[model samples]
Target: MFLAWNEMRRNKIKFGLIIGVLIMISYLLFLLSGLANGLMNMNREAIDIWKADAIVLNKDANQTVAQSSVNTDDINGKFDKSEGLKQTAVIATDGKLKENATVFGIDAKGFLMPKLEDGKLFKKNNEVVADHTLKTKGFKIGDELSLSNSDEKLKIVGFSESSKFNASPVLFTNDETISKLNPMFKGDKINALVVKDKNWKDAQLNKDLEVIEIEDFVTKLPGYQAQNLTLTFMIVFLFAISAMVIGIFLYIITLQKRNLFGVLKAQGLTNGFLAKSVMSQTIIIALIGTLIGFGLTVLTGAFLPEAVPIKFDYLTMSIYGIVLILVAILGSLFSVLSIRKVEPLKVIG
Candidate 1:
């Protein structure tokens, strides 16, 4: 331990550079994990809170909430208790709010309405529930807004937490208003039916109406699977790079101090003590750098804009921290083995 402490003091700059690299890698891992988790949450949180056992969509429409179409008959015939929703893209603009927005027309009295964080749910044709981000972006209650897909000018009736789907802030409205706005909709039907019953028989559902689990539907969103996969690959490669960087730095340090190690071995120091010291130094450096990096990530997250989705939960951070420490320990083991190979006889000659 004494020898390891002395070596670290002797080569502070080299150790500092190694520590800097480790910090950067650890920070990137933390950021990427948060990003992946955040994106998934943004796409699915509203659905997640529904606590519904099943979601019914059009069988031919695949899993998209926006594309699936189900009539009242499709739902009333099978589902014990169900709410119809029409997830469509209609351009909306408030003369005062500025910028055109995509609207998500849904049933005001349905299961979806309960997710509203503030104000009242949509009740009238003129009423709409906007996401919190939009409120910051320039929207307010009682503000009259015009929807482009249809002829209706609506009013903001409520606000919801940052509910976003396909990167667009969601706007909640009654099914009647949505049916009037969306041109693609054929009848007074919904894009999908949110089912609350667990005993729903999929076989008995209307042949055209497909019953999809909410979890499965979330993955079907365009680019969701691809985006998630790309982020996962990036995080994994960074972890590998972190391990290699630590190993190489310690290896080079051991080589530079070979003569000194030999002198100590000849002076009655056992190889085991020298090896343990090197490992202890590696672990100490890894721990200090990781902690610093994690702190930086937390601080940076505080300033991040709501538009830049980054999710960090305790479970995700804890798992990543554990992996970082494990890799650092592996790097230290290499240094310990190298220290053992330093021969006293060679140095005396």
Candidate 2:
């Protein structure tokens, strides 16, 4: 360790360059990871808030929520004593805020809906609760928003944090209002049913409907699977590249010190000590680089635009950091192998 420190001190510029490269690559990997997580949350945050164990969709809909249709009567009678909630979406906007928001028609007493960030849940047909994102787009309590293609207007009574679906803010309303807005949906017809029972497969239901785990349901959302798969592949590729870069950098550094290592070996230094020094140096450099990268990522998150979907989770970040360090250590094995092969007599001459 002392020898490794002395070498680093003597060649600060070379080590500094390698550390800088690592910092940049690590920063990029973390940023990409944050974006991937943020986008996934944006796509499924509203559904995740339900905390439901499983979702019931019409088998004919092919696992898609939007296309599925459920009759409230069937769900009520078949799943008696079970908490089954109906939900659906419609394209809506307030003219000033023109985006295709998903209107969720849920029972006010059900557990599927999330608590409001401000104000109360819907108590009437015309009252609605929306995601916090709506507030950012010029909406507030008492503001009346209209649906697209219909003259019906709903008053925003509350806002919930992180309540977004399919990249759009969610608007919670009652069954009555949704039925009034869309003639095709009458009485008990709903897009899907959310059930609290994890053992939904055992529940006796019409053969036409299928039960799917909530986590699996999220993947069925349009483009959700594809987007996540692509980003995950990119992250994996970056991890591989980082490992290779570290391996090459340490191998070259080890080569430059071949004569010094040979002399030390001739002077009675054990191979284990030399290998430990190399690994210790690699770990120190990796730790410094990872810290700098993570700090920069936090700073970037702080200044990022409100419109951009980006989230920083400490657990995820920690996992990423640990993986990076492990890969770097693995990369240092090449240097250890090179050290073991060093011929003390040949290099001393």
Task: Give the runs in model 2 whose Cα sits over 4 Å from its true position.
Answer: 80-91
Candidate 1 on 262-325: residue-level lDDT in tens? Answer: 9899999998888788778877788878888899999999999877889798688878988888
lDDT of 2 at 324: 91
TM per candidate? 0.91, 0.93
Candidate 2 per-residue lDDT over residues 1-349, each given as its tens digit: 7877887898899999888988998899899899999999899987887777788889999887778888767777454334434445566566666667877777766776777788888898889898899888778898887766678888999987768888888888887887777665776687787877656777887888888888888988888988889989998888888889999999998998899999999989999999999998898888989999999999999999878998888789889998998888898899999999999999878
Positional deviation of 21 in candidate 2, in angstroms? Answer: 1.4
TM-score for candidate 2, please give it.
Answer: 0.93
Q: Pairs clashing in candidate 1?
A: 34-311
Stretches of model 1 off by over 4 angstroms after superposition: 96-102, 183-188, 200-203
TM-score (C-alpha, index-matched) for candidate 1? 0.91
lDDT leader: 2
